[model samples]
Target: MKIAIIDDNSFLISSIKEKLSFFEEIQVKYTANNGADLLEKLDKDHNLDALLMDIEMPVLNGIETTLAVKQKYPQIKIIMLTVFDNDENIFNAIKAGADGYLLKDVNPHELFNGIVDTLNGGAAMNPSIALKTLKLLRNPVDFKDVSKEEINLTNREVEVLEQLSKGLSYKVIADNLFLSPSTVRKHIENIYSKLQVHSKLEAVQKARRNNLI
Candidate 1:
């Protein structure tokens, strides 16, 4: 399995490389200091299978990078490998199309398994991260005193947002609404732009706060 690690700290990158060095099947393709550098490298050669991305970095953060990568190369899986497991970061990473979420302290075996599972279409999340994700989905973050902005969403967009709030994937939402996945994605993009939110959690919470959903 070809993998790329992205982190601002050189020592952390080296540490992750050393951990992965235990696995014979896994190859450390390359390492980048930040998301911008990674994108430039990918533009030249994007044959990577997965990326171990750090959340906080200069030039471009992991969540923004994940969104850009998913839009450009949806085939390559991305696992957020960060030390911080806070709720905001988790939701933002998920909203940005992260395939998996793992902490930097994960054991080598667990990290390898996460990569394998993600490649096989599983949401490879650390046990704690998984629990947090479930909790966030069940009871989303509350935004107090959110501005009552008049965000105009079409009927179809509202339907899509409702499905998103239910924690449904794009494909499933498209199927349920009898729309193409691409169309659903476009609607979501519009929703994000109109609502000025970067994450599904934010969108849902704001919509509820404004009584749009």
Candidate 2:
């Protein structure tokens, strides 16, 4: 399988490459320091099967990058990698259209399985999502429990909004969060659905109007 990775940390990128080095079936076609770089490479060719992305970066953030990638290359799957398992980040990523979510500390084998599953038409969410779900269910929100509508958004979806408001790009955001550009996209989709809005600008506007932040 062919894959692309866009992250700022050269070391982490190398480590990931090494971890998958033994798998002859997996080929790392392109690697970039940020989302903009990934787009540059993609302009030359768009044949990647999957992307492993981070949520934060400097030039373009994971969320924005994912949004752009999904717009241009919807066929490829994206999987996010992060150290944070917060509700916002999780929801936002799902909203962005990510195929799966995995923690940085996840077992390599599990990561492998997640990658395969995502490529095979499956969704992957970090186990932490259940804890967040349980918490929300217990406490409930103050806003007439619109939480169900919000449920359509993933943790990563929230993360994307937080970042996008700051006017960050996918590449820069990915670098900050140590993820690839493609994975950043999946979360944006969830954000749209949860907010009951379409397009990035609309989602941000609605969230602001509703005081969703």
Top TM-score: which candidate number?
1
Q: Distance (Å) between predicted and true CA of 32, model 2?
A: 1.0
Regions more than 4 Å wrong, model 1: 142-213
TM-score for every candidate vs. truth? Answer: 0.67, 0.62
RMSD of each: 16.1, 13.2
- Mind sharing the TM-score for model 1? 0.67
Residue-wise lDDT of candidate 1 within 156-185, one digit each (tens)? Answer: 999999999999999999999999999999
lDDT for each residue of candidate 2 in 11-68, tens digit (9 for 90 to 100): 8888788777867778999898888888889999889999888876668867778888
- Please report, as a residue range, the 10-residue window in candidate 1 with the lowest summed lDDT: 141-150
The lDDT values for all models are: 0.92, 0.75
